[model samples]
Structure formats: C-alpha cells, structure tokens
Target: MKNTEVLEERITAQGCTEHLSAVEDAIYVIGGKWKLKIIIVLQENGNIRFNELQRNIPGISARVLSNELKDLELNGFVKRVVHAEQTPVVVEYISTDYSRTLQPVIMALSNWGKTHKRNIREDAF
Candidate 1:
C-alpha cells in the first residue's frame, strides 16, 4: 500500500484523534471571542496602536484587550513594537509572518460565518 494509504488507515483506525488534536491546538491559541476579531482588524488595517485597536473593536475593555494582546504576542501570532522616539512613546501591534499565513483560513471562516448567519435568518422567518 502507498504511504498515504497507510497514514490514512492509521488516522482512521485511531479514531482521528490526531486531527482533533491539531484542531484543539489551533483553538487553544485563537479560540477566545476576541482573538480572531483582533486578528481580523489587524489584517484589515495593518499595524495599529492599543487605543486604536480598542476603538475599532468596540465593546472591548482596556483590561481584556491588554490580556488578549499579550496572549497573541506570547503565541507568536502578533508582534509588539515600541517606539521610544516620542516623549510618551508609541506602541503598535502587527501580525507576524506566521499570522499572515492564516489569512486564507480567516477569510474562509468569515465567508462561512456570513452564510451561516443568513441561513439562520432565513430559518427564523
């Protein structure tokens, strides 16, 4: 049998636990309500400062945003740059190269979400 076939058999025989584990790992990093929102915002607008992101997100508190930003930074999905040139200093967050790799996945999820919402609306009527 082909190598692909053998791997497929292993996955199938193992109840697809490996696939589930991979998905769970992704969720652990980006599962929160706000992580994807932050990612989407950064993707759409490029780099942004803390206050700017809070303003764009709407309904997110300073504390929560801070925590999420830290988490994203910790996970290597975002980079924080601090500019000390100004008196008060400037801080901005931008997506890492790794995060950019997720753009297609994000866009696909977004489109699927829109369709799901429409389906719900139609079903409700």
Candidate 2:
C-alpha cells in the first residue's frame, strides 16, 4: 500500500487515546537498553555514525546495535543517512522531526532517574 493510505488507516484507527497511547508508545521505542543510551549520546553529540554509536555505548554487541538502530529508524525516532561514497561509505543516524516529541519524555525520565539515583546513593552511604 501507499504511504498516505497507511497513515490514514492509522489515524482512523487511533482515537482520543492517541496522545496518551503515544506516550506509552514512545517508551516502547526508547525503552531498550541501548536505545535510551543512544538517544542521550545523540542529544549531546548530534548526528553519529554506526561505529561511533557502538563505541560510545560500551558492552552493546554489534548485532544488537544494528538491530536497535534499525528499529529506531523504522519507528521514526531516528533517521539513517547513507552517503554514497567509496569503500567504507559513511552512514549517519540523526533524530527526525517526529523525534522532537520525545524530548519532554526524555527530560521527565532523566529527572526521575536522577532522583532515584540520588535516593539509592544516599541509602548506600
């Protein structure tokens, strides 16, 4: 089917719950181990290539990173740009306009994590 048809189908299917469910859906998009980390890294550093992402986020396997990046790109939160060059062509990942919707979600989670971390640290101390 065409892109417009798909979008219209989705809009028709989703109702008042769009806003509320969208927030939940956002979690599903960025909830993974590497996804949130990738977002945080990108938020700080701007666009990044595949290898750079894997390097910045230690302990994430190549396969896992590839899958996660693909998922992010598919979900409209991240975009993949392919540079048509010679060998070792550059591929960069950047956030999309739709991704701007994620900022408040990320900020809320950041605040929550900070508070939770402080509480845990204080308890340990």
Candidate 3:
C-alpha cells in the first residue's frame, strides 16, 4: 500500500466535513493571494520598512502591501514598529511570535510543492 492508497480511503461525511472546515479556516487566514507570501517575506527579512517590502515582493503595489500589512497587524501575525524619535519617522514590519507557529506549515507546503512539481515532470517523460 502506498501513500496515495491511504489518501484514497473513504471517509465519513462528518469526518470529511470536519476536515474541510479546518482547511477552509486555514484558507480564510492565509488564503489571500499575498498573505502567505507576505508572511514568508517578513519571516525571512526580520524587520523591514514599507518601501523595502514593496521592493522585495515584485509586482506588489504600495496600496496592496499597505492593506496586507494592516491586515497582518490586525490579525496579530505581524508587528509594526514606528520610530518617530529621529528627524524622519521610520516604520518596520516583523513577524510576531505567533507567526513563528506557521513555519512548519509553510515548510510542509514548500516540500509538497517541490514534490508535486517533480511528480508532474516525471509523468510528462
């Protein structure tokens, strides 16, 4: 029996619904086209300013990044720090402790993506 065989096993309606609900909730939180991308960037870069973030994530507009950062901050996954003590105010965004909890999920998805691409390439040959 292979991993795919186990995946094909029939599940009960209640069990299916429960599993779907969990996935749906996950999608709701990290579902946006840019949420996970933003999280991954912040996690890797540590603390970065708005302009830097915009530059790091190609094709993302300032307006969209602003919205996503606001949402991440609101959700407590990212922290925004504003430094007004200097001549020019500075603002930086960093992932929160809670955000670290997502590392395993991101790594798992990354591994799956790599495997899926390899499988597709193999099937094409």
State TM-scores per candidate: 0.86, 0.72, 0.88
Q: Which of 1 and 2 is ahead in TM-score?
A: 1
124 Cα displacement, candidate 1 (Å): 2.1
Would you list the rank order by TM-score, best first?
3, 1, 2
| Clashing residue pairs in candidate 2 (N, C-alpha, C atoms within 3 angstroms) | none
For lDDT, the strongest prediction is 3
Task: Write the residue-wise lDDT of candidate 3 on 61-96 in tens digits.
Answer: 999999998888888899999898966999999999
Q: Best candidate per TM-score, number?
A: 3
Which candidate order results from sorting by lDDT in descending order?
Answer: 3, 1, 2
Q: Which stretches of candidate 1 lie over 4 Å from their true place?
A: 1-11
lDDT scores for all predictions?
0.89, 0.80, 0.90
Error of 1 at 63 (Å): 0.6
State the weakest 10-residue window (summed lDDT) of model 3: 1-10
Q: Residues 14-113, candidate 1: write the lDDT tens digits.
A: 5678788889999999998899999889888888999999999989999999999999999988899999998799999998888888889898898979
lDDT of 2: 0.80
